[model samples]
Target: MIRVLIADDQELIRQSLSFVLDAQADITMVGTASNGREAIELVRKEKPDVVLMDIRMPEVDGVECTRLIKAAHPQIKVIILTTFDDDEYVFGALRYGASGYLLKGVSVSELANAVREVVRGGSIIMPGVASKALEMFARMARGSMQIAVDTQQTASLQENEWRVIREVGCGKSNKEIAAALCLSEGTVRNYLSSVLSKLDLRDRTQLAIWAVQTGVTADPYGDRT
Candidate 1:
């Protein structure tokens, strides 16, 4: 079973999510917290497989709590389930290793699947938020954003890998990338894993960030070197 913790300042949200998620046979609610501090504390005690976090909680905010949680327990996955879609919150949580960023508007089923997805080492982003993130990255790329990794590593990437990166930068999921590239989902996942290892990135979120920041998404197929 995928153990989950719900962290939200509102009692209703915390209890509601816990009730719905706990009903899933594959998921169990390990605990709930009303603030970031309590969330962090419960995380240490529960060591849940996934955390459904709210962004605007008092005391520590979800973004910082995610950082602390990941820093202390990298094995635990965090999904920022918030009403806020602001760029600051989106990128902040992602940069700190949040496995998913979903708006509270999502259905209970979508949220439940997201929890399972993250537990399987996949990243999830709401469609609207994904577009915003891509646009923000593109804007940043036009100014001063650049990939900090070694050029040789990037140049060593295969053409198919670049295709996968481009699709990811466009905010496509593995299933979408597979269909676009005419490959199976497993192949897309393999490419993602390969790219992550090649670039020394932590996850697909960082890979997408790197793709946009490096302008890979802007160009068509061509020699990157």
Candidate 2:
């Protein structure tokens, strides 16, 4: 079973999410917290497989909590589920190793699916948030953000791997990448894992940032420099 912890300041949200998610046979609600400090404490004790975090919690906030949780327990996955779609919160949470960033507006089913996806080593970003993220990355790319990549390592990437990276950089999910490349979702997952290892990236969010910074997403089919 996929164990989950909910960290939100609102008691209603915490209870409601717990009630719905616990009903899933594949999921179990391990605990709930009203603030970042409590979230951190619960995480240390419960050690859930996934954490559903809110960004605006008092004490530590979601971004810091994610960082602390990942630092102490790298195997645990944290997904930011907040009402805020602000760029700072989105980028900060992802940069600190959040596996996913989802708005609270998502259906319970979608949220549940996100938890499962992250547990499977996948990243999730809400569609609207994804577009904004890509745009922000593009803007940063145009400015002073420079990501140095190893030429030899990059040269070792296979053509199919390059295709997968490009799609990921474009903010496409495994399902979307599979459809775009006419490959199975499992194949896409493999490619993603390969790319992550090859590039020494922690997760898809970093890959997307690197892809944009390196101009990989600028020309999908163009020559690799």
Number of the top lDDT candidate: 2
Q: What is the TM-score of each candidate against the true structure?
A: 0.91, 0.93
Cα deviation at 181, candidate 1, in Å, is 1.0
Instruction: Give candidate 2 regions above 4 Å deviation.
Output: 139-147, 222-225
Q: Considering summed lDDT, which 10 consecutive residues are worst modelled in model 2?
A: 139-148
Model 1 residue 35 lDDT?
Answer: 96
Q: Summarize candidate 1's per-residue lDDT along 150-217 as a digit string, tens digits.
A: 88788778989989889888888777888888999888888888888888888877777788877778
RMSD (Å) per prediction: 2.1, 1.8
Error in Å for residue 114 of model 2? 0.5
| Tens digits of per-residue lDDT for model 2, 1-225 | 999999999999999999999999999999999999999999999999999999989999988999999999989999988665556786678777888788886888898899999999998877777787687567656665545568777977888888888888888889998999999999999988998898887788778878888777877562364
TM-score of 1: 0.91
